[model samples]
Target: MAEHPAYPVGLRLTGRRVVVLGGGQVAQRRLPALIAAGADVLLVSPEATPSVEAMADAGEITWARRRYADGDLADAWYALIATSDPEANAAASAEAERHRVWCVRSDDADAATAWTPATGHSEGVTIAVLTTHAKGRDPRHTAAVRDAVVEGLRDGTLVAPHHRTRTPGVALVGGGPGDPDLITVRGRRLLAEADVVIADRLGPRDLLAELPPHVEVIDAAKIPYGRYMAQEAINNALIEHAKQGKSVVRLKGGDPYVFGRGMEELQALAEAGIPCTVVPGVSSSVSVPGAAGIPVTHRGVAHEFTVVSGHVAPDDERSLVDWPALARLTGTLVILMGVDKIGKIAETLVAHGKSPDTPVALVQEGTTAAQRRVDATLATVAEAVRTHEVRPPAVIVVGEVVTVGPREPE
Candidate 1:
């Protein structure tokens, strides 16, 4: 008769005795999962990798500083034999068999009674893929299939059927510097459940395309040159939508609070008596510079970095920026939305005692595939801007820290 397939089941190993053989890479890889499953893991090895040693020191697992003995599996619920020596693994497996404990063999899967599956988790869902460990079976094919499913779920393409509770509220989500994958797990989950998404120009646009057909996406970019909308209009839209019992997500690029006008919207929601939540995003003020290999702060170079808006010129009567004070600071200065007024800003800094030869770096469309950097000194930056025809949404860095990183290309 042909051999029967092994039974598949999820083990409730919580607080149960589990023996893990070896102290190498394979054992290191399996130990975390066992600990997560609440297994009372007993690791047997004369020596262990640094990571395993650290875990033992942290009291996450018990380390038995000796080779696997016959009594190690006496009352164990399960055993994982991953020793480098095949003889040692076989001996552990033999002892587990005598105690009626199922064993998973890393070296010789066919010799073991159980097999570990490739696993992934997303949005409270755990996915595990298993393939027959019989002589002719391939594990790679199963793993590839598992990865595809997980990616689909993450990107919102492959969704499980369920009714999403549409509690009317507002969420300020920071869409990290243009990468769809950079959005936080909570931000993505809340977005998936949204009825309305008020999106800005800098947030991840690709993620918007992944939303269900019923999700109402509103373009919130309303500056004079950009697709414009007034702040009051945006506030009204959010209030109106939430009042109609719709879940609203105000998604902006970088962080919602870092010059994102997020507080204005939140205050408006609060006045309207609507529940609101803010989900912080990775701010581009730091991430964008780092992406271009520009460290805003380096040891023995810059002790602090200042982020300011350059939407208005330093000479503009409406401008709130203290140009004289900023010029006097001996640290890195970062300016956002300043491409249009960079010439005046540079001139003002130069006039205020900031060195004309101070290095500056202009990063455009930062943290995206279209990112490009224009390097110049404070005196020549205005001329370079005109030559490059640099546009808005670029970050300008000044001070010595601009030249602290890798050499810029000519």
Candidate 2:
């Protein structure tokens, strides 16, 4: 009999040696996440892609430029197969089980002990999105569905799961962006009723403060960066907590599903026969830019905009940013992780066709108390940020929308 695959109550992957059997965009897209969850990643690929290469060079993960061998799984605690070749992934999975390592095949849902869910995290919440048939699909297909979820998260249309139709006691809550005050009134109310808060580190400290002192709080870090928990641990925690007739708030930040991996968690709960609901909040993708007062799309200034992670799924030989399209188009271009790569981004845009004199702005800590604004032309923002020491969590806005601001004093 096959093991019934359901969403684990909650998940953690902290400090676990996990092998990624491929180095394409999927591995590139999922590696940072696994690392962020505190996994010690060992990337197995014949050749490194740009993203994977950068990570390996940074010493974030060890790169083995060879095929997956049974020896690689010897001490690995958890494994995920993300190779472009499905046959190779299957071979790796069999090796993983032989080593007794818990594993999930990125391209095949049923090939492993679990499926890595699409996730989103913010101030006080981490949500997982996964499919009921996660084991039945190709990893790329699984990731495609996850990407659709990512788009919903990007658009801010994705809400937390709400099965009020089936479960009366369950409540959905949004923990807000990296800040606690950003949470909504309804989210706070629902959180207050939660007996078990299945939360991740990103959940705001203040929001956690709102709970009664003794309320059970589960920290599913899922990586070695801090607490050591696994995805399975998180799933189990939610199920066990809720099964005890406890009101559980799977506290996730930034609208839960927005890269929060929320859908997986919700589906897991439902599959496990748990009652649930989802309350939405301001996702950082839009809110972060808007908070910085940078509109993703303005009436005339920006007609269309693309919001993508600066760190995840980066470009291959060249930038993933469609420079020519963005340059020729008349609209706003908001780059999230373009901060570190700001100079490169500007350089790319200028080389593509955008004027070197194009106006730009770097808003750091937007909508918060410590907001900073730096305005300059595409030629200057690179130096401007360096002179000012602008940091991450900052956003880059391009096009005429930036020029609309008042002139700097002479």
Candidate 3:
């Protein structure tokens, strides 16, 4: 006899009963979807994984501490039998069948009335793939298909309806450190829709290679220096492109507000009557140090971390930094664009009463494949920076917090 093909449907389980007859890995995987669907989940198990226990403790789900009884499925609209014991799963499936509730059996889908599909989501769209007609019900094929589809959505090869509408305006998007994967979903989507992208040298370079040929990419760092189009040129380019009814994206690195000069661009656009949007990106000050296994703050070591721009030398007449006050701070100090002036900055701190032996760390090209870490003290960091040839676009951390927290990458 030919088997009946399973029907596909999206169940609205909001505030409804959904019983899960296991607390192992399978239950852990399926529970999230059920809870996300707003199901009143009741989990039955003798013992559960720590994560499942934590969920129950958090009141996200109701846990039945004992084994499943025959009438456990009497009121369940849907039940999933994922217990390790074959007999327990079979018994639970039989009970669900008797109560006319749809049952999904992890051990034997052939005997169950429903099958879970491989699922992925992007930009308000949910994708589910089920190879119902495939012999032996291979999940690998469905998962592979789901992954390909989701990757396309993320990289802009596939576009969802909500993201298809590209309005003519400027979007200042922070691309995050250097890792392409670190770019926010919204930022990536906007990058795909951009007709012109004015990008910083530190922005995610890998993503630029994947953009469509029609998108004009301008390297902000290479913008003609000393020409009228330098800073003004960049500003004029944004305003001109937006006025021409083109979607322009000023792709920057790190959080736009974190010394990224994003406000300057925003003000330029506003004065020109060009509408603009700002999409925040993860800042390197915290994330870069975190990538190198250093915490900016530790409970007992340090409570505060200050981020400062070290582009200008401490003794430079145009400098605004209060070196004396910065030297007195007891917490962590993070300096950006300070590699060249690190020698002077170090001397200034020490001259202002900062201990010469204070621990310090320099993270170069953080969160990317070229990530390198060098450790020293206030007195020795200058020599270490020179010896390591630590370049610009690096983060400098000073304080006891450099030695606190996780020392090794997990």
Candidate 4:
């Protein structure tokens, strides 16, 4: 018989009976999709894998605990014949034919009435790929094609500009801690859909280069004690763009709520009667330290980790941090934006009873190619910072947990 192209069609199996003739790896892989489609799945096998048995125990599917019988496909809308026994598989496939049910045979696709394509979904789009040749069918080729399409859709490389749904609002997207790939999927998608982007200096800078020419990239960088953009001005720009019915993305570094001033922007938009969407990103307080091979908390080493902003010195009147209380806690302390004030911070912690010998690590430009770690003690960290010419935007980790992981990169 000559091989022919398979006509692909989606099966709406909701509330439909799907009889699976095996409880092995093949059935384990396919059962989830069937269950997700709301299919009433029935498993017919004398023995089953642990995963398949768990599914039956959970009532996700019915298990007969027996071999494939003649009447097993009596009223099944779809059948999957995947038993280890070839004779049993053939019998089940033949029974499905008599019942006029669509059947898929795992052992012999050419003999089955249907074939499952390599399927994937992204951004509300389903990608299914089927590769057929006169010689044979290549499952790997089908999966590769499906993966490519799904990835392109997810990253907006395959987006149709004309088909885009223009949502006119301000999105406070966390671009994650320094790394462009660390940004959330929704954040990246929102950025691709943005007409106006107000970005910070600390956020993922590499992603900005990927934006289309039409996107207006605004520099809202708040450089430390240097040339900077005011928060009020950034808020006004977000409001102004959103009022013009444009999609605005306020791309910030790290988690928006984690000392990112995300709520301030959200509140400003709310007062201006503009809608806002907030997409959270991985916080640098933990991720940066982890990138430098330091765990903020370790068993029997540090029981708790505290994240604090060190933009202000402990003696400064504007500082709200309780230095005395923080020093008394037997845990880890992670400070952000405190490189310049490290001298005063170290003095305050040591004076407040924290040991001068407490280990400290400064991770600069963490998770990026420029990442470097500088180690010191509470008494020596201030000098270490000055000696190394360490700059702001570095995460300062204090306490014993700093010494719990692999040695800092040279």
In model 3, the runs with Cα more than 4 Å from the true position are 1-5, 15-28, 39-77, 82-101, 133-135, 155-164, 179-182, 222-236, 243-245, 266-277, 287-304, 316-318, 357-391, 399-410
Candidates ranked by lDDT, best first? 4, 3, 1, 2
Q: List the RMSD of every prediction in angstroms.
A: 3.8, 20.1, 4.9, 2.7
TM-scores for every candidate against the unseen true structure: 0.84, 0.49, 0.75, 0.93
Candidate order by TM-score, decreasing, is 4, 1, 3, 2
| lDDT of candidate model 2 versus the reference | 0.70
Q: Give the Cα error of residue 143 in candidate 4, in Å.
A: 1.6
Candidate 4 overall Cα lDDT vs. reference? 0.90
lDDT of each: 0.87, 0.70, 0.89, 0.90
Candidate number of the best TM-score: 4
Clashes of each: 2, 62, 1, 0
lDDT by residue for model 3 over 236-325, one digit each (tens)? Answer: 888998999899999999988899989989999999998999999989999999999889998988899899999999999998889889
What is candidate 4's lDDT per residue for 32-90, written digit by digit as tens? 99999999999999889999999999999999999998999999999999999999999
lDDT of 2 by residue, 1-410 (tens): 14354655564779878888888877888888888888888888898789789999999999999877768888888887887777788777888778778787766665677667666653345556565654354545556766666544433335453445424334446676567777775677566655777776655556676577667776767422335246656666777777777787887766777656677778878898887788887776666666655666767666776655455323445545566666676667777756877786777678778899888887766556666778888899889989989997676777776655453332
Stretches of candidate 2 above 4 Å error?
Answer: 1-172, 178-181, 200-204, 219-236, 316-324, 405-410
Q: Pick by lDDT: which candidate is best?
A: 4
